[model samples]
Target: MDLTLHVWRQKGPQDKGKLETYPAKNVSPDMSFLEMLDEVNDGLIKSGKDPIAFDHDCREGICGMCSQVINGRPHGKQEKTTVCQLHMRQYNDGDEIFIEPWRAKAFPIQKDLIVDRSSLDVIMQAGGYTSCHTGGVDDANAMLIPKPTADYAMDAAECIGCGACIAACPNSSAMLFTSAKVAQLAALPQGKPEARKRVLAMTQAILDEGFGNCTNHYECEAACPKGISVKFIAKLNREYLKTMIPTSTDA
Candidate 1:
């Protein structure tokens, strides 16, 4: 199948970018999206043209490195699928694909389809962890957590931090991502010791990074490749508020 990819090319963060058209001929239906890109890059290299720069590692969709906006959607329109997991069978013979790097101030363009996502790392560094000393793996019965709570913790822990939630939001909010981090720990018994501190530190860090507040558009949930629900944001808000309110134990 033939495909025409309109890809954005930029020299640097400060450089202006424009869409460049390239023809992808005979794309196999079984070929993954990154494999299609490899074919395109091979064609470019043979023609003495610069290849498209995009991130990819562990192309099995386990890693969130395959970051690109495809046809007005992050990771294409496939539900719960990353770009690397996207296959050409989803498109037709003459389909025109528009590809671009993630557009956000915090994730400035590095070159072509590559963007710096280190701002997320900075936010995580600000306190997305529980510093308590967890002893070596104890027997399962030792920590005795309710099954429902453990399930919720794992549900929230599914977040891969792909930034799709941020890109899909009209407000460019990181609430879903932040909330996922909050909930994964908040629901766990081990994390209860620093629950309030974890909530406070992460909330402030995300705000300081200049991400917009959640406005309930729910685009974040729709765009998440992991299907992490926007309900996590609600959990975050409640948890953040709990941090401010005086509890008998915290007080």
Candidate 2:
């Protein structure tokens, strides 16, 4: 299959970028989207031109590093699929694919398809942890958590911090990603002690990093590669409200 790629190219964060066209000839339908880009890069190298730059690691889609907006959709149009997991076969021959870095104030473009997603790291650092001093691992059976709660926690923990939620949102909100991180721990007894502080700190960090607020657009949940639900965002809102409500001082 042959395709026309309009890829965003920028030398550095300060450099103004544009969508440069390149021909992807004889692209294999079986090739992963990154592999197709690899082939295009190889051709550029041979031609003494700069190759396209994109972030990718652990091509198995576990890393969530392959961040790209393909044809107006983050990680392409495939539901619940990351860019690394997307295959070239999804496109037809002679398709004109527009590839760009995630568009968000919080995720400034580094070069080509790479963006400074360290804002997410900053948010993670702000909270998303419990400082429990349990020295050794405890037996799984020791904790009497309901099975449903454990399952929900596991589901929330599947978030890979891909930042797709922000890219997909009209307001460029990080609420879904932040909420998932909070929910992963907040659902469990282990995360209860720090729950109040965790949600407050993380949500504040998101704002400090210049991320937009969630307006219930639902785009974040729709674009999440891990299928993390927006219900986590609601949970976060409730948790945040806990901190805002005044407590009784008199006994």
Candidate 3:
């Protein structure tokens, strides 16, 4: 297949970027999107042209590093699939695809398709942890948790921090990502002690990092690769309130 690519190119963080055109030809329908990008880079290298830069690692779709806005959709409009998992067959031969980095204040463009997503790292550092001191592993049956709660926590924990939620929202909200990280830890008994501090710190960190607030937009859930629900925001909100409320003993 032959395709036209309008890819964003920037020299550095301080440099402005523009869409530069390149012809992608003979692309196999089975080739993953990143693989097609690899072919394009190989062609550029052989021709003494600067190659396009994009984030990708563990092309198996586990890493969530392949963050790109393809044809105006994060991860190329495939429901629940990452950019690394999208195949060439999704597009027609004469298609003109536009690729760009995630657009958000917190995610500044490094160059080309790469952005400084370390803000997400900062959010993770804010919470999303179990600080129990266990020198040895405990039996799975040692704690009795309702199966439904465990399942819900596991689902939220599936988030990979790819920033699709922010890209999909009109105001570029990071609530979905932050909520998921909070829920993952706030579900279990080991997490109960820190639940109050966790949500407080994480939400404040998100605001401090310049991410926009959620205005009841469902786009974050729609674009989420893990299909993490916006209800996690509600969960986080409830947890946030707990921080201000007195504990049972004090009450």
Clashing residue pairs in candidate 3, if any? none
Would you list the C-alpha lDDT of every candidate in the order shown? Answer: 0.88, 0.93, 0.90
Query: Which digits, one per residue and each the tens of the lDDT, describe model 3 over residues 34-141?
Result: 999999999999999999999998998879898899998888888999999999989899899999999999999998999989999998888868788768989889
Pairwise TM-score winner, candidates 1 and 3: 3
Write down the RMSD of all candidates, one decimal each.
Answer: 1.4, 1.5, 1.3
Q: Per-residue lDDT tens digits of candidate 2, residues 134-234?
A: 68988879989998999999999999999999999999989999999898889999998888889989999989999998899999888889999999998
Off by over 4 Å in 3: 248-251
Give the candidates in order of lDDT, highest first: 2, 3, 1
Clashes of 3: 0
Better of 1 and 3 by lDDT: 3
Clashes of each: 0, 0, 0
Model 1 spans > 4 angstroms off: 134-136, 248-251
Give the per-residue Cα lDDT of candidate 2 at 190. Answer: 91
The model with the greater TM-score, 1 or 2, is: 2
Q: Report residue 77 deviation for candidate 1 (angstroms).
A: 1.2
Write candidate 1's Cα lDDT for 18-104 as tens digits.
999999999999999999999999999999999999999999887899898999999997989999999989999999999988887
